[model samples]
Target: MSNDHGDEPHELRVSKIRSGTVIDHVRGGQALNVLAILGIDGSEGEEVSIGMNVPSDRLARKDIVKVEGRELSQDEVDVLSLIAPDATINIVRDYEVVEKHRVERPDIVEGVLSCPNRNCITTGDEPVTSGFEVLEEAVRCSYCGTIVREEIASLIDTA
Candidate 1:
């Protein structure tokens, strides 16, 4: 609480990342979405921090996610792009960002990355593995064998 009205200073909470990945420029309100999509919740004892609506030159207002002691796998990166497509992945070591990568579309997607169709086999009792083929700019579900056009394929936002 500052007594000065117009010139009051704001407190900023920032933590240091000793190692692992620092995902920046996540779309506003989607950092946790990216985390859930990446299956970080299932990682027992793994430390993770998420910041939403932070200031950024690239995104203006954006979300950021920092994962400690773990590196994102290729599959995880693909999942991230599906949710927060414009995010940047930064690899940090010794408190320095050693590598950076912009999210890119993957050639194909496998397993139950997303529910193919509400009535598809993968969503039924059989628990069949789902697959998809990346078309020019879309991913087609191979189970029901339906093409999930890019525009319509974005409905699978949940983890």
Candidate 2:
């Protein structure tokens, strides 16, 4: 029994932002993690929209995050790539996308993530930031050589 309306065009599922950035093609079930990466917890009252586990052509299902009046810095983007490698960053102004680009995995990340190793120097009271070298499937701490792969989102250090 075919009721048949599959070919009809669909309207936008999520509202667009007047200015800011839209992170598209995030892997399914990771939108909340992406928000965590962006440091948005609604305390600051940021205008944000999230589409989680939405149907997608590329990933079968994907997540999208839209932030109004905010754009991600290089450090934030680099960290975002750790989880959402296929994500495309779209800068919007006046409800139009001004620039669109994919997140590139950096060779080395610095002063962003906190090393998980408790004994690592960076974790001490010293004025040192963490550094990690990106690996094929994990990130290795430059200080203690600790390797982290699973639940990379949980390892995000927003401090």
Candidate 3:
């Protein structure tokens, strides 16, 4: 079946995790940001595999992240939606996909992201946690009313 067409059907195989999570359909070039959101810096011995700017049918280009030995929390997945709204989270167990779901935006996010406003109350010495109300495409600081619409993942404080 050697045809003259330059295009040919193909498939890529990424290793499967025995137990953990696989985040698929991430917006291309945001794989590093996804790692940051999950607090993985390579210093904590997190087993991670990433494929960026890969060919996709659902998107022009997409990224995939496979994290070993860990399942994401609801709060973590909520923040993920801020960047990769179309991502599909797959929970693997015993080399099988035990569960799969899409990330949903949360109404509020607390104690996860750092407010950029230096004068905001959450940045002060007072014992107050950061809070933000999730918007349609952004997040509004609950304390200082600062709206963040760009580089949302840069405000992530996984520490």
Candidate 4:
């Protein structure tokens, strides 16, 4: 709405995804990583729209990725959690949000991913797997073993 004082109406940047998921609240600089993990590029060319360093009321700066005509699998969501835990996944169909979910990290992470550590066995070419157990709300990186503690996970403060 325009103000009587001659102030222009604020423009809202809203777009339709057509189908698939809209991942919002992704931490800045992590959108591309999430996209890579989701294998969005491996699939047939889908309309992928990304907005980085967007202003957020909740997070001072946030990122968003919208993929068209593709619904993400549960495994994909789990991968998203590893990189963007505060992410909000919106299932969009016909330009409407059909379902919304907050990404949550699972307790025991299996073959789902390789440890982020470069020197870890999982990161090696030779096919050694890394597994972890959630001991007291922290995910321990089993191989080159380190802990992403609950406190670290909970520190989503983008301010």
For each candidate, give its TM-score against the true structure. Answer: 0.73, 0.94, 0.92, 0.71
* Shift of residue 104 alpha carbon in model 4, Å: 0.9
Instruction: Give residue 129's error in model 2 in angstroms.
Output: 1.1
Task: Please state every model's RMSD to the true fold in angstroms.
Answer: 5.7, 3.2, 3.1, 6.6
How well is each residue in 3-58 modelled by candidate 3, as lDDT tens digits? 34456755554777899999999999999999999999999898898989998888
Residue 154 in candidate 2, Cα distance off native in Å = 1.4
lDDT of 1 by residue, 12-120 (tens): 5458789999888887878767766766665587788888887766788899888888888887787567666788999999989989999887777676366547887
Ranked by TM-score, top first: 2, 3, 1, 4
Steric collisions counted per model: 0, 0, 0, 0
Instruction: Quantify all predictions' global Cα lDDT against the true fold.
Output: 0.73, 0.91, 0.92, 0.72
Ranking by lDDT: 3, 2, 1, 4
What's the true lDDT of residue 9 in model 4? 72
lDDT of 1 at 48: 84
Maximum-TM-score candidate: 2
Please give the lDDT score at residue 73 for candidate 3: 95
lDDT of 3: 0.92
Error of 2 at 60 (Å): 0.6
Q: Which 10 successive residues of model 2 have the least lDDT summed? A: 1-10
